[model samples]
Target: MTQTCLVTGGAGFIGCAISDALTAAFDTVVAVDNLHPQIHKTGARPAALNERVELIVADVTEPGTWDEVLAKHRPDTVIHLAAETGTGQSLTEATRHAQVNVVGTTRMLDALAARGIVPQRIVLSSSRAVYGEGEWLDAQGKGHYPGQRSAQMLEQGQWDFPGLRSQPFRCAHTKPAPTSVYGATKLAQEHILSAWCLAFGTGLNILRLQNVYGPGQSLTNPYTGIVSLFARMAKAGKSIPLYEDGHMLRDFVFIDDVAAAIVAAATSDKSGILADIGTGDSLSIAQLASVIGDIYQAPPPHVTGQFRNGDVRHAACDVSATRDTLGWTPQVDAATGARRLCEWIDQRPEQLERL
Candidate 1:
């Protein structure tokens, strides 16, 4: 039988890429999205989405959204990409985060179990957020996992907290130590899905993705995607807003690379496997801002004393397991990806006006 696949958040940045790839593999693909106005105001289908896939405008938080859809489609594969994003916003909108991320995921799994149809495979778009603070090391070169950054510590700009001469250590696929509301909920989503899938014998692939950025990301949203924000500001002839010392590190994986990894996991008959989907690379926030400025020929970002509470000091993805298991690796280098993103913004000058 020809297989059917369903993707939630199907029109967003990563969602669009995944949907496009799935269309090439599956006979039919359907997407469900509520089209949050902050990220997507068009209300119309995204121009880049494949025409073959059907789109249902619905809220994942509402029960019937999945209940009715799942009953009708009975999709062979389900790629759950829908979730509330952002560390800062998640702190402020705690309830909404729980509703959309935690409760929403529970509803999806609940609906699937209600139907008593174990999907051939289910892939949940997990996040690097789950690993709140990156692994840490001390003066003795021993390992450590620091808790949330304190307000006083961040306020005085005492960035590093040494636990008996301990400092930030680098590691990947380490047990998640989520530091924010968003991180907590994402971790919860993973736990919920893993337990449910195991109990029901549904094949599961968890992609612990790193910071994903690319062309389709929202330019106007202030709460997520530093790359998108920088590009948008540059287009408007504004100075990039630098936070902290601009030394906080992160692993930025391109959207196309992430989409390919998700498809590789979702379609594969592989079960009970979790992989770190990243470049195993790291870059500082200041460096990223400077590069984006170079792309637009804009002014260099100014470093401010401001610091985000839940932001990590540094993080780099470990893609060894990802390559070993799925035989997948990130293909797009950061420079090329940044150029493509800047070009995308230039192509849609009107969207820049929305900034």
Candidate 2:
């Protein structure tokens, strides 16, 4: 008997990659996505996945629709990745994020319970934003300085210059302090998953992913698609805006690695656990621009802009749990991944022209 998998937001970037991976592994794959224009531009559809996979265009928040999908598919595994994802915008549209991320997740859990068909596993695509802003503790369980200083030590004179510290940061395993509405919604979703696991005995695996970038990413949207935006600008010789002094550090995980991690989490015996999926390395926007320039074999583009509000200065994952539980680690480093992304973008001039 072949196993069936249901992937919510299967048409989106990471979701599409997960869908492809599922089709290769499982006997059947069912993808559910509303294809929201906020992420994918209006009338813009995600690239088609395998022909064997079935696509359903429905919002997960709608209880009626989920029941229909659940009854029709009866999937053994449900990978929920559909949600309103944007830190800055989530502040303005808190209710919207809550509705989609929190309410939609509730609807899915309820539908599964109603059918009395508990899936073998439930994978959630969460975000690192749940940790929120502030000084994060280092691996040694010591409190570190905020922002870039947390990751690196300052020189002798630099220590007194301003933001520099000598001790590791204090990190606690407790309730998250969400800085944005998006983070709050994700926390709520996590709580919902925990409840389902405890109350209904459903298997759950939560993946709190860092910045994931690769090809087929929509570049036209400035709110998202930072890598795509930079690639387009580099190809067209346009100025790229660097949010903040371009020193904000981020852990960029390749899309393929993310897909692999999701698949592993679904297949693994680990349940009711949260794993951070990232390369465990940090790179700044300026450094990222240089890398992209090198990939395109072009001069580094000009960067102008201050860091926007609610932006995390530094975010790198501790993938030990992910490795120990799911047996997954990120393979693509920032430089190699950026080059791959550039190569894919370079083949399509029309995409650059549109942006």
Candidate 3:
């Protein structure tokens, strides 16, 4: 029997990439996306997307659409990538985030069970934000999960955590301490999938993606996509804003690497595999701006003392588990990946107008 795979958010950045990869591996591929206005103002598919894959414009929150699609196609595998993303904005907009991420995931799982369509595997697109403050090493080399940064401390320009001020520390194993509503919602999705998989004996692969950036990232999303945001700000010759002295670190994985891992998870016999998908490298925000700026000749970002509430100080992961589980390792470095992103943006200069 030919294998079929269904991917939600297929028109978006990671989704489109995954859809293309799935097409190469599977005999049948179906993509479903509502084309949210925030990511796609025109509500149209990108010309660069693979033409061989089938597409359906539908919301995951809507049962009517999913029920029909699931019953009709009966995909052998399912990759769930449709959800709201924006940690800082999610702090202020709890209801919208919860509805799209948490509720929508539940609805998708519920629809599958209702239709008796147990896929061979379910690959969930999770985020590193679930780690919240993440793990930090102290002066004595003891790791600690720091609490929330106080507003008063931020006002005083105290960017570094108290223990982590003097020495450098690397991230350890992820212990979820979601600081923002967005993080909490992503954590909820993991729980939901775990419960559903356990109850039904379904194969589940949870991918905790860390700061993915590439050609098709949303340029309009104000709260996330720092790479795209920098490109837009650079094109307009506007000074980029760097929050919290620009020393905050992130593991920015290229979109292609992420897509490959997603396909691997769907096809490989990797059940009960929960891993962090990243390059296991930490790049500070200041360095990120400089890298992107060189590509577009964008002015240097101004380090603003301002800070967003519920933002994590640093995010990186131990990707050794991901390597063992999926036989996947990151191939693109941050500098090389940033250049590819800028080249793509130049081809579609109109994307800058998205902001």
Candidate 4:
């Protein structure tokens, strides 16, 4: 008998990519998404999946919605990707983020429990924001800075505590310090998954993805992924807006690579494990803008405004654990991915306005 896989938020960017990959391997793929107009307001629904995949439109937070789908499908694997995901927005709409990210995840786990089916695996799409601003430690490990930023620190890639020598920069792993409501809720969800595994013996795989980018990304939301926003601006012949000095660094992982990692995690025997999914490389906002400009044969982005609240200067994943556990690594570099995205935009001028 072939196995069944269910992917929540399957209509969204990353979720859609994972659903397409799962449909190719699993006998059945059930994609559930609320089709929340807030995240992806307009665009043609995501394509590139086999006929075996079934699309279910429902909010994951509602208990009644998943009960039928779960009972009918009884999926062997559940990849939960549904959530309200924006750090800045989450700061203002804390309640909504908590309702969707934390409450929705709890409901999904509850649905699985009600069916008396402990799925072979449950894969969660998490985020690096759980680390918050990331801890800064000195060489002696005695000094620590939680949320302080300095110009000298950025230049040297080292943060200095008042009384200690500067040390290699490190994000705090001691305790989760979520900077935004979204990050806090994601951390809560991760802990909840861990608790479920310990209490019920369910297998769980948590993947904290970095800045994921590629085609099919909705560009209407400027508050979300930067790559999509930049692509949209370039296509429109408008200068890309730099949020800061364009020095903010981010780990940009291609969508295909992210999908491959999710597939690997679902197939692996690993359980109750949290791993970072990224290319292990950092790119500045300016660098990213230049690459996109090159791809579209357009002028460089015009620096516009300064960084706003809840924005971190830099954040990148280690990816060592991901490599060891999933046996997967990013295949597409930033340049290649940017070019591919530009090509897609060029081919679909009509879709630009919809985004």
Q: Which one wins on TM-score? A: 1
Q: Candidate 4: where is the Cα deviation over 4 Å?
A: 39-45, 139-143, 148-175
TM per prediction: 0.95, 0.87, 0.93, 0.88
By lDDT, the best candidate is 1
Q: Rank the candidates by lDDT, best first.
A: 1, 3, 4, 2
**Cα-based lDDT at residue 323, candidate 2:** 74
Q: Write the per-residue lDDT of candidate 1 for residues 89-120, one digit (tens) a residue.
A: 88889999999999988888888888887888
Better of 2 and 3 by lDDT: 3
**Candidate 2's residue-wise lDDT over 66-166, tens digit each?**
87797788888888898888888887878888999999998888888888878888898888878764454555656543432221223221212143322
Weakest lDDT window of 10 consecutive positions for candidate 1: 164-173
lDDT assessment of candidate 4? 0.77
Q: lDDT (CA) for every model shown?
A: 0.82, 0.75, 0.81, 0.77
Ranking by TM-score: 1, 3, 4, 2
Distance from true location, Cα of 167 in model 2, Å:
10
Question: Candidate 2: misplaced stretches above 4 Å?
Answer: 42-45, 134-141, 144-175, 297-305
Q: What's the CA RMSD of model 2 in angstroms?
A: 4.7
Tell me the spans in candidate 3 whose CA falls farther than 4 Å from its real position.
Answer: 165-172, 353-355
Candidate 3's residue-wise lDDT over 62-81, tens digit each? 88878768867987888888
Candidate 2 versus the native: TM-score? 0.87
